[model samples]
Structure formats: C-alpha cells, structure tokens
Target: MESPASNSPRMRLDHLRKEGSGETHSRVFELEPCDHDNWSNPRFGSMNALEILRETVRILRYNSSGFMAIAALLICPVSAVLLSNVLVDLSLVKRLTIRLLLVSKSSGLPLRPFIKQSCQKFAEMAISSATCFPLFITLSLLSKAAIVYTVDCSYSRKKFDTSKFYGIICKIWWRLVSTYLWVCMVIVGCITFFFLVLAAVCNSFAIIGFSPNLVVYAAMTVGLVFSVVFANAIIICNIAIVISVLEDVSGPEALLRSGALIKGQTHVGLLMYLGSTIGMAFVEGLFEHRVTTLSYGDGSSRVWEGPLLVIMYSFIVLIDSMMSAVFYYSCRYSTMESSDGEECQSILESVVVSPQAMDVQ
Candidate 1:
C-alpha cells in the first residue's frame, strides 16, 4: 500500500547499505597493509633484547654527533673523576672505615677480615660518591636528559634540535632531579637492607655455633641474592628516569610506571645491565692497572692510556643510557599491542552494532 516514491527511498537505503557493506570490507582490507607496516616498524612493534640493542645502536649511529657532544661535555668529566679518584678524600675514607668498624664491634658482631674489607671498600665508595654528588645532579643528569631527548627525536625521524631540547630540559630538570634523589634513596635502602639481613644471618649462625666456614658460605649465598635484587632495582630506576623525561610522571609515579612497563621484560633488562656492567668494569680495571697502579715508560703511558680509558668508559655509559631509552620504547610498544587488541575488538563490536541500529531506524 506504500507509494512508489516511498518505495524509492527504501530502495535507495538498501542500495546504500549494500555499498556500506562493500566499503567496510574494503576498509578492512586496507587495514591489513597498515597492520603489516606497523608490525614491521621497530618503533611500533615489540622487540626482544637483542633487537632493542640493535635499534639503540642504529639510533646512536644516526645521531652520533649529538650524542658524542653530550658524552664529551658531561659524561667524560664524571668518568675522569671517578676513574682517577681525584675528588675522593682519603682521610675521610679512613675515618669512615674506622667508624664503621667501631659500630660493628660495639654491636657485638665479630670483626672478621671480610667485614673489615667490606667496610673499607664501602667507606671509600661512600666518600667518592659524596664528593661527586654535585656533578651527578648537574652534568650527569643533564647528559641523560639530552641522550633521552636525542633518542626520541631520532625515533620520530627528526634531527636533534638543541634549542628545543634545552627548553624541554629546563622544564623537566626539577622532575629529573627529584626522580634521581628518589633513586639514590632506594639504592641506599637496598644496601642497608642487604647489610641488615647479612648481619642477622651471621648472628643466627653464631648463636647456633655454626662453623666460620659455613657462615662465610652463607654470606656468599646472600651476596648472590643481593646482586640480583640490586640489579633489578637499578634497571627499574634507569627506566624510571626515562619515563620521567619522556612522560608527564616523575619521582615515585615514574618508578611505579616503569615497574609496570617492565613486568614481562625483566630478563631482557637484566641482560642489558649485565653487558653494561661488564663493559664498565673492564674499563675500570684497565684504568686502575695501566694508569693508576702500573707505570710504563716513566708513567708516560698514563698520559694517553688514562684519557683513552676515560673515553671508553664514557662511551659505555652513553650506550647504557641509550639502551635504557630503547628498552622503554620496547616495553611501551608491547604494552600498547595488548591494549590495542582489546580496543580493536570493542571497535569491531561497535561497528557491528551500528549496522543493526541503522536497520532498525
């Protein structure tokens, strides 16, 4: 009983629906290429540890000039001071060592040779760190910020804009500083916890009349556990620094976000940390032997060897920072993929519901 004019409108609606269905299928086909491209892109796709390292190297190569400048200006100074121990006060180290020994003796703990050695090393490290704390907050942190920003620009297919980077750093400097302070506190807390636990274990063994050898073995086991925990903590803090610079979060929130981001990627982080630690240690050993302890040709070898080792040490540090930045992206990309799957499903459901609603209308 409908008029022919009304029938025409219905026919037109049916034709449009048919066209819409075809277009939807074509859109889906188009998305396949996009998905493939995204999956192939290193920045968009999830990467393994080795892949991340490769990408970091690529980024470094791409922005070598910028990174080198940052390393020379900031990182090299820190490395030189640390390697030469120029800023460390030997008197302060001795006093601190004595204080630590006295405290341990007063606490009724046995002052074994191992304990004395540990105290001496700890005191020296503490003094050096205190002396270099200023450099750490200023130049070292600035270098990290610069490296992170440069890596981000490289990933985005842009050049490093110094003026823009400076502006960005100025705004985020406080945040970076706050995050670093928190990181230091966390590290100190971990060391304190390690010592307390070690002390307790030793005390328990003493009470049980355990052999000294057994106590030493137990201490070694504890040291192994502490090493793993400490490595994990360092990885988390490094990622937190990246997060603080690249995102809006800082301090504890950045740390929490980093922990969440790295949940399934701890092994990768551990491997990266291991590689960097080894590289730095090797450089330090070379510096200690060639420049500080051993003398060759009236110590002229140190003239070149010391600077060469410092450069190597700085380069290692640069790579480590870059790796941390790349790791952040790798973790972030993986996280996005999981979230994107859920989003795509919801979108598909909505698309399906839309046609049904149109039919009802």
Candidate 2:
C-alpha cells in the first residue's frame, strides 16, 4: 500500500508475522511524505530578515498550528505573568493603604475592615506566588513542546494531533531538559564573567580616582554589550532545541547541528531576536505603566487590564516562537540547498527509515 501523497519522498514499512520459527509472511506499506514544501516557503532561504519575519507573522496568523501553540501559551506563561503582575500591584496598594491609614489615624475613619482586607490580600498574593512558581515551570515545558510540535506541523502540512505531538515530546523531553540545563549554565557563566570583569575595571578606575560619571558610563556600556550577547546566545540555543526535536538527535549533537545550520544566518537570527526582545519589553512596559497611571474608578478597569495584558503578551509569545521556528526552517533549507540537496534527502531518509527498527509492532 502506498501512502497519501505521490510526489514527495516515501517511506517503506515492512510488517512481518512470525510463523513457527520462521518469518515467512510480510506486509509492506509505503508512506508518502506530506504536501508541505519546506524549501518553497517564502520565509525559507530568504536573505532579507524583514521578509523572514513577515513570513513568520503570516504563518502564525493563518496556520491552525499557531492557534494550538497560542492556547498552550495562555494556559502557562501568560497566567504566570498575570499572577505576578497582580501580586506586584497588590503590594503597592497595600503599602499605599497602610501609609494613608497611618496619616489619617486621628480622623476616626473605620479601619478594621480595610485592615482585614489588606491582610487578606497579602495572604492571597503570597499563596498565588507560591502556586505560580511550579505552574510556570510545568506550563513552560508544555508550551515549548507545543511550539516544536506546531513547527513540525507547519513543515509537514499535517493536522495537529495533541496526543501524538505531546507523546513525541515526552519521548524526547529529557533531551530538551539536558540542552536547557547546558544553555542556562552557559548563560550564567558568561554573565558572571562579564560582571566580574566590569567590577575589576571599575575598581581600577576607583583606585585611579576616576570620575563617578565615567565609572557609571563604563558599567552601562558593559551591560549593553552583555544584553546583546545574551540575546544572541538565547537565539542560538533556541534553534538547537528546534533541531533536536525535529531531527531526534541528542543534546550535544543538536548543538553541533544547530551551530552548523546557523553558520551563515547568524546575523538574521540576531536581528529577529533583538526585534522580538525589544518589542516584548516595550509592550510590557506600556502595560505596566498603564496599570500604574490610569485611574480605574472602581478597580474593575485595573482587574480587566491584567487579563488583557496576559492575552496580548501570550499572543506575542506565540509569535516569537513561530518566528524562531521559521528562522530554523529557513536556515535548514538554505543549508541543504547550498550543500547541493544531498544533505536534505539524507535527512528525510534518516527521519523515516530509522523508525522501523524501534517502531514496528
């Protein structure tokens, strides 16, 4: 039996039933590849970073897979952020209320109910923070897994199957965890080293009686450089995660693969990363500013702002993931094409044929 599409590469699966010490009967099923053209997507292989980013947005807007990813984002990170913001706002309110009560103590306004409510709010915020920490970690993993699954569907033009996708993620979750650990270690080490260097430099300046302004300027410069480097590092590691999921490779192998895959596309990746990071920061800042500045009459407007910000930021998270996935595909397709297509064909063969030994039932 042949698979669905005739034009794409096909997988031949052989099923055998043993018969008394010999395997005489066998069944063959040809599995055709999906209709999606990975190489032909406008985002794939485009040298213009804007073109690539625009294509990424287009996919997230038009593709059903993107919605699945968005759903996962809403459940996890978005909720976590919203809860955190609420706690922060509540803390501010608590401080302000305490100050007001102290200043008006002699005015004889009823204070028992207000004090009780303030204490209750504090307790609630504390519990929410404690609850949100674990929830954040768990949901982060799920959201990331969903992003990888969505990227695969985007490439293959396959329908999203939550069970199957997450099952694959479960099988490979350890690899993701391992890569994430290493990535975190690298980031922390670099940041520590940078700070150490900055301290040494500042100490030297201090010893020489350098102006305070100059010392502060030096610190700012170092911080700016560190931010840029950190963002780039994150972009590289994210691509490695995508490769690990798609290629079913080990953590170290995925790192090596990503390094090679992104060899010529580093600048493009950096641009997209910077744009996404800056955009996120700007939007979040605006949301927080509004929460602080606007008068919400009965406090309901403030209540609604929290959820609105969550939804907006959740969509941003989804788009950012989609952009990274698009960038990964673009780099992979471009690398394969530049290498004369043999690499691409071999990759497909490895994906399909390697499953037979372990997957046959």
Candidate 3:
C-alpha cells in the first residue's frame, strides 16, 4: 500500500484508522497558519501596504459595518457648527417669545417658521446621532466576556475575539453621555456668564456705537479666546472620554491616560477626526439644503429621502468607528514586550492578568 500520505487537503477517517499503529500513524490533517501571521511579517515587525488594506477591508466587512465613519470623516465640524447655530437661533427665539409675552404685545408672533426650524434642527441632530449608533456599535457593543466566549470556540488564538468587540464601545457610550452632561453644565454656565458680559457691553454700546472704551475691545478679545479654548477643551475631553472607556479607568485617570496617548500624536488624531467631520458634513449639507427647499410646502419630493439619507448616514457612522478602531489598534501595537506578556504601547495598554499569574492567591 502506498499509504495515503497527504493525499489531499483532508484525509478520510478510514484511511487514518487503517494507518494507525503503536509506533507511527498518519495524522488526520495538517493545519494552516492563521491569517494574522500571513498579514504580519516577523522580520519587519509591521504590516506592509497590502496587509494594511486587507485588514481595513476585513474590519469593514467583519463588523457588517455602517457608513457614519466615512460621513464622520466628512461632516463632523460643519454639522457641529450648524448645530451650534441652530441652538443659538432657537434660544434667541425662545427669549424673544418670553419677552413678548411679558410685554403683553399681540401674541400673534409668527409661529410657523420658528416651529418648522426647531423641528428641522432637532430632526437633523436626532437622525444623525441615531445613525452614528451602529457605527459606534461596530466597536461599541462587544465585550471581553464575549471575546472570551469567541476565543473558547476559535481554533486559533491569533484571531481577534470579535464577540466581545463592543466592550470598548459600551464604555464610550456611557462615558460620552456622562461627559456630555458634565460638559453641557460647564458650557451652559460659561455661556450664560459670557452672554451677560456681552449684554452689558452691548448695552453700553447701545448708548454709543463702537464704544471707544478700551474695555469693550479688550472684552471682545477675551470672548474670542474663551470660545476657542472652550471648544478645543471640550473636543479633547470627548476623545478622552472614549479613550477612558476603552482603557477601563476612572474619569480623571482616563483624562490623564488620553493626554499621554494623544501627547505625541495630536496631529494625526486631528487629521483623522477632521476627515470624519468633513465626510459627514458634505452629506448633511446636501440633505439639509434639500430640506430647506422642501419646507415650502413641497415636502413631496423629499418624503422618502429622509429615511434613505439617515440609513446612508448611519453607514458612514459605522465606517467612522471602524476607522477610529483601526488607527487606534495600529498605533497601539508595540515592538517591545514585558516578560509576562504585556506590551507598552499606549492605546489604553490594557494587560489582563490571569489568576495563576496574580500574586493574590
């Protein structure tokens, strides 16, 4: 007998059984190396161009990803600015409405436009935010327990445990809501104070055009600087919140950890964030512009468009999360490692210690 030595990709149980012996036997099958090994080069200690693209595609497909990331890459800043403007307008209108009632003027203030605008703005935000959820879920909804569950069933340890993937995302969600509330409180307090000071300055100017008081100009300068600082700090805090959640640390700890991670990498992170913002904005602009046209009692053409845009926007959000996850993991990889199987790279740098390794026992 020739003895079916590696006859095919897989061997039959009958052949293996027949070939079995005390001294020698043919194994049922030979295993191939995991995909990761093929994508990574040991000599280079980094993925090459092809591998990078492949991994990117893998991530997008793996999560059954959405488009928010692509849109986030596009429209983040523009949408943020627009949202801010809408909020300012709505606030102004509300103030006017209350002031009118107090003065007992004809309660016939034009309600249609304001109501329409408010609804439009709210719809935009809610829809955009909701679409962004799935993108976030790509990385947002999985867990370590899920990862362990996946690992338990996986034939190789080299693959990412896709199951618990959302642990980081869940943390981000909780942290963002928490951070948003905190930031809103701070922003509200500061904005209230800012407007008061501005009102005083404006009232002073009301008595005189472009009041020559150096104090007025100085106050103007102060306001500009304050706005810039406030905006930048909040954005940084948002990123820090996400970092914190992924890293599994206290709020303050997360802030410091994010600061460290972002210290040398601010420019890269900025560009990527900007990309997400730009992509989202272009799509948002088109939709909003169309909505503006539709508000003229011509909602006919756009009746079906809103949901379609939302779904497409959600896809972008999905892509946005994937992009963030990719960039994060890429930067997080380290060439150096501790003896106990830990790496020093800073994307959270979480190292889980097993019971056997811990000194607690």
Candidate 4:
C-alpha cells in the first residue's frame, strides 16, 4: 500500500543488491566516501615553513630505510669529497689565488686585509667544485631523483620500490640533468652579474673621487641586495629541479613553472633554505674543528670523526632534498586549489574511482 515515490529508495537499494556483487558494492560505497573526503580535505598545500618541516620529518619517518640507503649510497661520498677537499689541487689553487691577486693589484683597486685569504679559499672551493662536477651530475642528480620518487610514493601511501624508482629515474635523468645545468648557469650568471655591478660601482666611485669609506659602505649595501636576490634564485632553481623531475618540463621551462608555483610560498621556501644552510654550516664547522684542526692523540680521532661528520652532512643534504620535494607539493596543491578547484576535485574523484570501475568489470 506504500506509494511508489516512498518505495523508490528501498527499490534502488534492492536493485543495487541484485545487480552488484558484494565486493563491488563495498568498493563503490567505501571508495565514494573516501574520494569525497579526499576532495574536501586537500591536506598537501598551503603549509607554512614549519609545517613543511614537519611534513618532511613525517615522510622521513615513514620511509627511513629507503632514504637512509639513498644517503649512504649516493650522498655520502659527495659530502666526504666536498668536506675534505680531497680532490682539490692545492698548487693549482695557489696559482689561481696569486693570479687573482696580481690582477687586482694591477687594476689598482684597494684590497682589504682579508682579501688574500678569501681569494685563496675561493680558489680552492672553485677547484673542488669543478673537480667534482661529474659526481654532481651523476650521483647527486640520481639521489635527488630517488628522493623525489620516494616522496611521491610515500604521499600515495605506497612502499618505496627500487625497480620502479629505477625505471622512473631512467626516464627522467636527462630532464633532471638539463634542469640542473640551467640552474648552474643561472647561479653562475647571478654571481657574475653581482661582481660586475659591484666593480662598476666601485670604479665609478673611484673615478668620481669618492672616499674609501663611502665606497666600502656602498659595497656592503650591494652585497646585502645581492644576498637577497641570490637566495631567491636558489629557491627558484631548487623548485625548478623538483618540477622538472615531477613534470614533463626541463631547463628554462621548468624554471618558469617553478616561478609560477612558488607565487604564494616564497617565505616558506626562504626559511627552509635558511635552516638548511645553517645546519650545513654548523656541521662543516664541527668537522673542521674536531677532525681537521683539533685532532688529538696522534690524530686517531680523524679516523672516526671524519666519516661521522660526512654522514651528518649527508643527512642534512637528504633532509634538504626532502624539504624541497615537500615544498613543491605544497606549492602545487595551493596553486591547484586556488585556480582549478573543480578540476582538482574531479581528478581526485577519477583517481579514486578508476580502480573500482575496473574491478567491477
């Protein structure tokens, strides 16, 4: 005696029960709610710097074994070489330092008291970096690829698969290398431009009869501005590397995409960069003091202290790379939420439903 309209709900349930298997019923019902939740909850974006750090820690905890393996196999040797400066040619560095000094003296520019030591250190670093270029292009880039892949797997709630990551890396290696080369060029260009501008300002002041003190103040001002610009460039380049690996972009295209992605997240990126820089500097200082300069009891401490510091440095590198990946996700999520909300929701729903749809078939 019930009205047809009142019976419609029960009839639809009965129809579903008859038409769909138990597994399909559960899959459809359970997955639909989860998909809605995922679409509503979008937890990946709009995180502050501290939140990003927290997320990185969470990710590390989730896949500590995989990340640690990556650090040991790929990052540790690079860290050791860089920290110890083992491959740097001292004689070549000394020659380069002398040449730089001679050029500066001939140019009649005023040299500060610390200029000689700074020049020497700079030459050594440049030599070391150049000598290690192959390693950076190969192992360092590979490590970054592995880290990014692992992070993606973690977010997707999947275990790290070595074979899968290797396949992904094989596909993305050239793109990553291209992006890295562009990043290097951009950084070198920034440094060159900074020096050029500083030199021009100093030369102009000299020609105009400015006081030495004023010139020093002017140089300091320029340095401050350069530092800010350089930091931004580094952040952009780091993000660009992530973009290149995650997307089908590389080089200038990847850099452009990164710039767009980080529109609302610059502060977060800067703070992350600052923290990583401080950690690295602290570890390097400890290495220099404990292992290199303050060796005790016939320098036996170096045997353990050196490797330990290298491991610590490698850990910092791993963390920095992980942060970069997390930051990319944050920025991308925010961008999608802001500009393509409906699209994002649809994509999430589709992703959740596709497997169930296949299972039903």
Candidate 5:
C-alpha cells in the first residue's frame, strides 16, 4: 500500500497526490491508529482529559518565558480588579444605574434631573463595559509579550508568531464583553423570574398574617442567582479565554464558533474552567469562613481578604491561561476555527507515523 505523504498516516493509508501538494486521497484500515507516532493529533479524538492536561502542562513548560509570561498575565487581572475597586470604584457604574432607576420611579423628581441621572449612569455602565475588555486584553497581552518577547529568554530563538497574539486578542476582546452582557442578562432574568415566584408565595403567606417572607424569599432568590452566576461566570470566563486562544476568527466570530462546538461537550471544558475557579474560590471561601472571622484589624475591618482574593483570582487567571491551551486541543476534535492559520496558532499537531517500505533511490 502506498503511504500518504501528509495526514493521519497512523490509520494506515495509501495516497496519490502531486509532490509538494497538500491535497491527497488516503484510506484508513482500522479505527485505531495504524501509526501511533502522532500524539498531537488535530482531531484530538483519542486522548482523555487527564492525558490532555498532562500534555498541556508539558507544552507550557517547554519554554520558561511562556510560563513566566502567563504568570504575569495571571497576576494582572487580580491586581487590576482590586486596584480598580479601591481607587476607582467600578460599582460607581452600577450606582449610576441605581440613581437612574430611582429618578425614573420618583414622581417628584424634575424631568431634567431624571434625564440627567439616567443618562449619566447609562454613560457610566457603557464606559465601564468598554473599559473592561481592553483592560483585560491589554494586561493579558502585555504579560504574554513580556514573556514571549523577552530578548534573553531561552526559547527566544524560536521565532515568535506575533500575529497569533493579536489574533487571540481580536477573538476575545468583544467576545468577553458581549457574552458577559448576555450572561448577566440571563442571570438577572432568572433571578427576577424566581424573585417574582417567591415574592408571590411570600405575599400570599404574609397577607394571612402568618409571617413576612421578604427575608427568606430574598435570601433564597439571592442564593439561587449567586450559584448560577458564579458557575456560569467561571465557564463564560473560560469562553472568553478559549475564544482568545483561537486563531481562525475575530472576537465575535470565535464566540459563535466556540458556542456551536461547545454545545454538547461543554462538561469537561467547563469543568476544566470551573474546577480551577472552584478550587480558588474554595481558598477564598476558607479565608472568609475561618481567616476573616479570626483576623480583625485594630481599627480596620479588613481581614486582608482583598489581597488574598486578588492572589486567588490570579491563580484562577493562571488556570485560565492553562485551560486556553486545552481549549485549543478540544476545538480540533470538533472543527471550530479562528481567522488565524495553524502556522500562526498555538496548537501543535503530532507528526503522524506510518508503515514504511525501503525504496530504491
């Protein structure tokens, strides 16, 4: 049997195509690999999650610069969020929303004041939303650049694919913001639906003068919403990131592509995301549960949760970085794409091996 020059030669194949050409007709004899040389198979069809995870770590560890750059990017998000809270108070954006909602409801408020408040808050949320993706992308890219482009890194000699990074940013920038908007909308909608349900139940019982249900209803509603949002946040955050690692599409396109591919198989990928997030969140929760209750400052109520949360969030960021690598793997199994080419992408395909025949030259 003639062997195909390019493709899953591991499946056992015969091929006929012009030399130096990519197109060819090849056949496979068995379901299993006839040639086992290809580990980084684009199909990624065989490896389990554990094997993928092992390969992922191996790939990252290949270059020390890659590792360090991702590390810095990991820290950037936590630092930005904490600093933004302390120095800028992003809730001010939501505060504007609150003031507007109030003005709208107030009959005594003048028309001019109502419009002013509404417009101001609307403006704030918009600015906050817009600022978000860029900040995240900048911090991430800056860290990647810092590590990948370092002049003295051992692997610096490996010509960096500069287009790959920009492609990632393009694929994630708008995606993170828009999907996040949609996710928040979904969560708010869910909570609102449940709130109304519980509210009705509460009002019925309260009217009989049995008991006020506001606290219980509110607590239940809040808990359900929090749980859903927290879990979704981890996955969506992964989506934002998985979208980034894609090289074949822009931000919006990657979202569409990934969404379509992730439909039935999001469990492992989502776990790959939320698992890390939950682990970090558990650490943060431990701090809140045991540490905060134990460590109160002299004049400040600060339990140092801020810094610890920041650190844990950074660890999430690292896991996020690592997960993106797997996302690239999982993607190939299902044919998702980005605007970037494989040459420019981070995914590495294994060199498929095949049976050989000694040739007379």
Candidate 6:
C-alpha cells in the first residue's frame, strides 16, 4: 500500500486534474479526509499510563542519576518531618517538666528557676522549628530542580554534570518557585471555593433541616469537586514545570505553554498523574504493612520503621518524577503531531482546491 506521504497534495492534485472531471475533484475532496487512522495507530497514539510508567522505569534503570535524584528529592521533606517531630517531643517534655516542678513545692526547687529553664527550652525549640521551615523550603526547591534536570537528561541520554545542571537550576530557581506558588494557590482556591459553596448552600437551606443523607451527599459533592480540580491542577503544574526546565521560560509563559500543549490531551496527563500517585500509595502501603508485620511485637521495630519508610519514600519520589517526565515528553510529542497533521491538512486543502485547479476542472 502507498504511504500517506506518497499521496501528498501535489500528487493528489495532479491525479485529480488528469482525471479531468469536476465530480472526481469534489469526490476526492469529500472522500480523502485527513489520514487520522495513522494518527490513531498504536505507534502514533498517545502513551498510556502503563507505557509512561515503563518509560519512567526504563530511564531510571539505565541512568546512574536516579539514586542521587531520589536522595535529593527525599532529604528535605524527611528532615523537616523529623525535625518537627523532635520539636514537638521537646515541647511536650518541657511542659511535663514544668507541670511536675509546679506540683512539687517541697522539692526545694524555686519556681522561677524551673519556669525560666522551661521557657528557654521552649524558645530553643521554637527557633529550631523556625529555621527548619526555611531550610525545608529551600532544600525542597533545590531537590526538585535537581530531579527535573536529572530526569530530562536521563531520557535524552545526556550526561549529567553536577555543576552545570545546578547552574541552570540556580538561574531560574526563583521563576520556577514563583510558578509553583501560583499553581498551588490556584489549586487551593478551587478546593476552597467548593468547600465554601457547600457551606453557603447548607446555611442558605438551614430551614430545610440538614439530615444524615444530606450531609453525606454534601461531603461527596465536595470531595468530587476537590478531586477533579486537584487532578487538573497537578497535571497543569507538571507540564508547566517541564516547560520551565526545557524551554527556559518562566512564570505565566510556562503555564500558558503548558496549557496549550495539553489542550485536548488532558486525559493523558490526568491519568498519568493519578495512576502513578495511586500506584505509589498502594506500594507504599504494602511496604509499610510488611514492615509492621516483620517488626510485629518488637520494641526495636520503631527504629527500623523510620529508616525503612524513608527509603521506600525516596524510591517512590524517584519513580514519580521519572513518570512525570515521560508523560511530559509523550504529551509534547502528541501536541506536535497534532499540529503537524493540521498543517498538512491545510496545505493539502489549499493545493487541491486552488483557483488554478478549479479553473482546470
């Protein structure tokens, strides 16, 4: 069979003119729609969630940067959580000690000394928490930048250079950070809007007497809206980040380009994000359960659980970042193909129905 290219506009026009019939020209125009079957073929079709995940794993498997990327991504969040937990424990201990000191007047301990000690400890913990917050944010952003560069390089089979890669990140770090904040605010706004709408409706209909069924329905409604909005926001942000990394664009331009890229292909992005997220959660849950079972009835298991969870989480972050990169490339490929197909069709129409061709007819 002749390929689509062999039947280009020039060839088709020559063939139709040779036939020298108006009916033939019109019939050819009506019959030969764009070759969308080729577009729909598996080779050309959009990548499915599994295919995206496979590509992600394939890149990670072949690339040496995968582990480093995972470490970079996980360090900040894990450290922050650990720090916060430690601070909480310290605060609680301080409170307990102060309470005990107050209750024991006969211990010959001055209240001022104990109170001052407790306050000092409290201030130290507060300062630690405050410092950890900014460090967490900075580390998280740096890690994200590293992961993005790593995944892009891995997929493109480019060598990863630490200094060069970070240099690129440092250049646009603020722009990426700003874009991230904007996307977060939009997602939060959507979820908040739905919650507020539900609340307002409930208040306005107070006379109707809210029942158990109504409460359940309202909860479900809020959940559905929130889920849809969150999924969309995630997909969009993922695309925007990819754009920012690759195209060197920033802020709203990155976002606009992302929106344009995923115009009719939102489902692919949505599925990619949702599938990876759910799969990671399920695997993490299984791992946690196994850890618990192994450590069942063991006092020393607590020590192992934290480290094991961190390792599992790091792996999850690596896979998640890789999958997102694959999805971005796939979506960008689809967008380009669609645009090319449209351009081809337009050129074909202009050639086939040209004034000269109609005159010849």
Candidate number achieving the greatest TM-score relative to the actual structure: 4
Q: What are the lDDT figures for the candidates, one per model?
A: 0.75, 0.58, 0.40, 0.73, 0.44, 0.55
lDDT value for candidate 4? 0.73
Clashing pairs in 4: none
- Across 108-164, the per-residue lDDT of candidate 5 in tens digits comes to 222345346545645554555455645545665455322322211211123234343
Go through the candidates in order and give the C-alpha RMSD of each one to the true structure. Answer: 14.4, 14.9, 15.2, 11.8, 13.6, 16.3
Candidate 6 local lDDT, 184-214, one digit each (tens): 5665677568646655654444436666445
lDDT tens digits, residues 27-135, model 2? Answer: 3322224433433332224344675666555455446655655565445465546534543455655665566455323222234564446445545454454445454
* Positional deviation of residue 336's Cα in model 6 after best superposition, in angstroms: 1.5
Q: What is the lDDT of residue 204 in candidate 2?
A: 65
Q: Lowest-scoring 10 consecutive residues by lDDT in candidate 1?
A: 6-15
lDDT of 3 at 230: 57
Clashing residue pair totals per candidate (backbone < 3 A): 0, 0, 37, 0, 12, 0
Give the C-alpha miss distance for residue 251 in model 5, angstroms. 5.3
Candidate 6: worst-modelled 10 consecutive residues by lDDT: 25-34
Tens-digit lDDT track for model 4 on 1-361?
A: 2221221100000112435465442101010112212422433236677767777887888788889999999999899989998888889999999987775444334677665766687687778889999999999988988888777656555566765565556556788899999999999999889878877877777778887767766767887899889999999999998888777789999999999999978988889999999999899889878987897879999999999999999999999999998888667766766764432322211322344433433
lDDT of 3 by residue, 110-183 (tens): 23454345435544454444455443333332321222222211212123322223342333445444543454
After best superposition, candidate 5 residue 82: deviation in angstroms? 2.4
For model 2, what is the error of residue 220's alpha carbon versus the real structure, in angstroms, after optimal superposition? 1.9
What ranges in model 6 sit over 4 Å off?
A: 1-45, 69-136, 279-298, 341-361
How accurate locally is residue 354 in candidate 6, as Cα lDDT from 0 to 100?
49
